[model samples]
Target chain A: MTEAQTYSFFLGCVMPNRFPNLEASIRKVLPKLGVQLEDLEGASCCPAPGVIRSFDEPTWLALASRNLALAEMSGHDLITGCNGCYGTFKDALAVIHEHPDRLKEVKKVFKGMGLKFDGKVEAKHVIEVISELGPDYIRERVTRPIKGIKVGVHYGCHLLKPSKNRPWEQTQKHTFLDELVEATGAESAKYKDKNLCCGAGGGVRGSQVTVSVDIAKEKLDNLIEAGVDCIVDVCSFCHLQYEESQEQLNKELGEKKYQIPVLYYTQLLGLAMGLDPTELGLDKHVVNTQPLLDKIQD
Target chain B: MTDSISRETIDSKDIDPEFVDEIVKAGADRIRTCIQCGTCSSVCPSGRRTAFRTRELMRKALLGLKDEVLSSHDLWLCATCYTCLERCPRQIKVTDAIIIMRNMAVDHGFMLPEHRKASQKLLSTGHAVPIDDANREMRKDLGLEELPPTTHSNRKALDQVQEIMKRTGFKDLIEGEKMEGN
Candidate 1:
């Protein structure tokens, strides 16, 4: 029989609550592309940059390995929406794949949880899979083309950093997101500081708010400086930091020189795929996407 | 009590005690293994931007310069992108060190009030910060809808967070906040 067309979806922390719209959009859009997101019961945070940073190596190894093992058990490839989840799983797999000794240690940690990870499963960021699936196929599947919507692309830190196993390599010049957005007939905004971080990293916001804001401010200021209509990103954490920090920074800067809505690329993709604003959960983000919705609806 | 206090306290004449050692013994046990290779420093984007140095922070932590590590803004400068942890030769969890320092600072009342205010907002509202009115107007101007619904406030969600934190001993670590009262 043909292999099942389903995937074990890993919705890391923040998606269910902080950015429910992004999740909704993904769920609404993926099915149209013939991808079925299989549910895995009882999955926890990737504990990335969080537990991994704070705990012993074995603890982090076991924690991330446990997440991978969950996907492995579900008999479908592990597909995640969060950038941190993607990075943690890919990083753990790389570590275990490269070091036999480390794999043994991870296995020992898993054994304690009465689990064993043979490292056979594949971990993919949602965007990586989409990019691999080819923009042409994506374009053909689009029921709605987001014409006239000018969008700024935020590739995020984890996905862009390390750049290992990046599905496409453009040595001279490449904008993976811009290319994809254009495939939907949307205009990719030309923004300076298009690559700055959202400062959600290092668990900084959770521990040190001042630092986190300081970091996010740099990115927001840059995007505003560029004059983008809206910010679109693949990582929910980046989406959260950028969306929330833009509002906070506007207050701090004492003038509303910039106010841009944040969209998980999936939500934007959902729109391009002809999904309705309500179906994509656009009403749910604290940053508000009403303006974008109106533009699309109009 | 005076003798015990004197023994525990350092005078102006004493060398700066190894504060990093104290933290390591206090469960940040990965300090001594750091190799100070500068891999973390070079790889850090913020370090590249602001001269933030994780290697220097690790060195200070290794030397037990508690006051130096906690007071210096370097720890705050990290974005926690995990680049250092990925590239570290000795596999030092540089970002985790920063978190530990922040918690220690907050516990000691060294935290900025703004940071505390934000945390309170998160604790109460299940969000890190509030949305500004201008942002609301901007969203309307952009034709997007109002704030979306959330799955954060439910007992199941909160309980799940607590359970995970418990599993990771993260609650106990942050619970160190209470020790500040003493």
Candidate 2:
């Protein structure tokens, strides 16, 4: 068995504030997977790459560096469940490394806070942590094995983008997430535009709700056509877009059209590990996950 | 009729020849090498539904159309998925250029209202989306703490984040009365 790993957990705004359920799932599953999560206490927002980075580059770098500084102080690499946060941390770090001037600027800001950041801590995604465990190791822990359930895996950009910084082999046609989904005893359903954005990133969801929901509606239409039991994703923001957009689309169309439940990857893995659905926060989803639960029972 | 005609034509006064240099300096170093191959736009998911044509935006930036580029509503439409950046044959950081342009836009006081609200939230609570009563209840129900150990629960941490924002001038940037600098 591989040695257990520990990380300073960076909880961005959405998961803890909007959907504590996803946070609950991660807390429930990672311990069983031999991953320890330490709270990066007092760590503020990943400052949200989409909104903050767009508004001011310098502030984005300094704030991201502060969070990285906290993790460095904790002596562990930082890991986040949201792709937007992951993108901010990774993109900010890449910028800091590429431009010495930016790093100097961030360090100057850290100086006042009694903090020192040597760019030691690396930002990681939860999926990256699980992927390191290998699929065989994951399969061995499946107590319930959610067999016959079809899942549409939504990678959501930022997990694999700015390819130069990411560790993924291929950004466009990557299958690491699909392979992980299959290990949970659930079939990763093939869908149109599988890599399409859930339409919530880059502050588009905040500024233009209709357009954001319209983008999500298109992807949901594709997932519906593929007959997936649920849409599993790695980002809480994407999870919110997928879940809320379905309800919004149904309202706009004046029909109960889109109903695909959205599940964070850990939630799916937790279910496969025989954890109770309630403990996984499946009961708190915007769209009912009872259909998915019924499928697993059958 | 005059308004329509003016909109159709590019005015020389609107172009700032140094704009491309500013974007390049802001970290989209390969943007000037764009060949108008349309690969970025072709792969852009936002372009499919919105007017966010990545190639067109790059062309405008290269042409130094500062006023037109910064003030366009289409500028905020990019989802920043980086699909365009990944598919660019010139290895141009297409999305990064857009983000750089967005920073420039905000510097020029062209930010969206919603974004300003988000920034305000960050300054106030250290979270773009601050925890509400309902969220607190949900966390309690989940057997988690009423607040996660983030800036929301820790006042000193929140102070540190606010300090960073203040030092970075982000507090003033968003709190300033006029976003358009009229």
* Residue B35 error, candidate 1, Å: 14
Model 2: pairs clashing at backbone N, Cα or C within 3 Å: none
Question: How do the residues A1-298 of candidate 1 rate in per-residue lDDT, one tens digit apiece?
Answer: 1155578887665665456567667777777777788764545556454433333344445556766777787677788888777877876787788777877876654443545477888887788778877789888977878877888888876786545534448331358778887788778888766666677775566666666777777667777777666788898888878878877777888987556888888788888877777777677676768887778767
Model 2, B57-112: lDDT tens per residue? 88989999999999999999998888888888888888888988999889888998
Q: Which parts of model 2 have CA positions greater than 4 angstroms off?
A: A1-4, B1-11, B180-182
User: Which digits, one per residue and each the tens of the lDDT, describe model 2 over residues A1-298?
Assistant: 1124889999999999999999999998998998999999998988898889999989998999999999988888998999999999988888888778888888888775788888867888999999989889999998989899999999988898888889889537989889999998999988999989888999999999988988998899999999999999999999999989888888888999888989999999999899999999999999999988998999
Instruction: Please provide the root mean square deviation of candidate 1 (C-alpha atoms, Å).
Output: 8.4
Q: Each model's TM-score, in the order given?
A: 0.71, 0.96
TM-score of chain B, candidate 1? Answer: 0.63
Q: Count the backbone clashes (under 3 Å) in each candidate.
A: 23, 0
Index of the highest-lDDT prediction: 2
